[model samples]
Target: MDNKPLSFKGLRLLVVDDDPDTRKLISILFELDGAEVLTATSASEALEIILCFQPDVLICDICLPDEDGYSLLRKVKRLDIEQGRITRAIALSAYVMDEDRQYAYLAGYQKYLHKPINLDELAKAVNDLAQLQQYA
Candidate 1:
């Protein structure tokens, strides 16, 4: 494991989760890593934020009160594609089944993470995805 701190300076991130504690924890983690973090409790709120926030990455839970993460990822993909933007997304969920992982990939997530999440791994994954985007 890399002990170097994740550098997310100037990057914008959106974290969507119905659980307030989850949201706060993730937000603090990213913020501490130097990313500007935004939180949304539902898919609808996330979609609305995406329009203006134009985040570099989205970390979202699969389950929500309004809509599922898969649906939200689809919409975000479509919107970003049409707008000519590259916004990578990660599926952060409690569903760790093989089928769930497959479905998440099919739904267009760049990464899949299961809760309770390992913050170090999450940082590494996000950093890796951001690096990929830079090359893309």
Candidate 2:
């Protein structure tokens, strides 16, 4: 068994959040799990990074400094299609309502996770989404 103890092996992850601590924590954890992570403090930065980084997956906070995660995901999804690329996205928020979850799904996020986040759940979500990309 090539057990390197990784849940994000070989994944390129883009983490977008306004909170410095949240961004840093996610980045450190994912990096430890063998993922290449890039973080953006705002939706604009995320958009710019998406064009260049072309991450395999995105983990975005629902509340952003500029635009919300829902809007950001829509823009990112459109841009990806234009570039003939496929990217997966996950939404993280403190909002734990059924409607919020529905909105996130409709906004192009594959998974919606609540905050304060569970690191293990986040890792599993990333792994699951990355696996789905292989089929896409």
Local distance difference test values of all predictions, in order: 0.91, 0.91
> Could you say which candidate leads in TM-score?
1
Identify the leading candidate in terms of lDDT.
Answer: 2
Residues 1-136 of candidate 1 have per-residue lDDT tens digits of 7577679988889999999999999889888868999999999999999999999889999999998999999999899889998888899989889999999999999899999989887888889888887876
TM-score of every prediction relative to native: 0.94, 0.93
Residues 1-136, model 2: lDDT tens digits: 4444547778899999999999999999989878899999999999999988999999999999899999999999899889998899999999999999999999989999999999988987888889898788
How many clashing pairs per prediction, in order? 0, 0
lDDT of 1 at 114: 96
Roughly what TM-score does model 1 have, to 2 decimal places? Answer: 0.94
Stretches of candidate 2 off by over 4 Å are 1-6
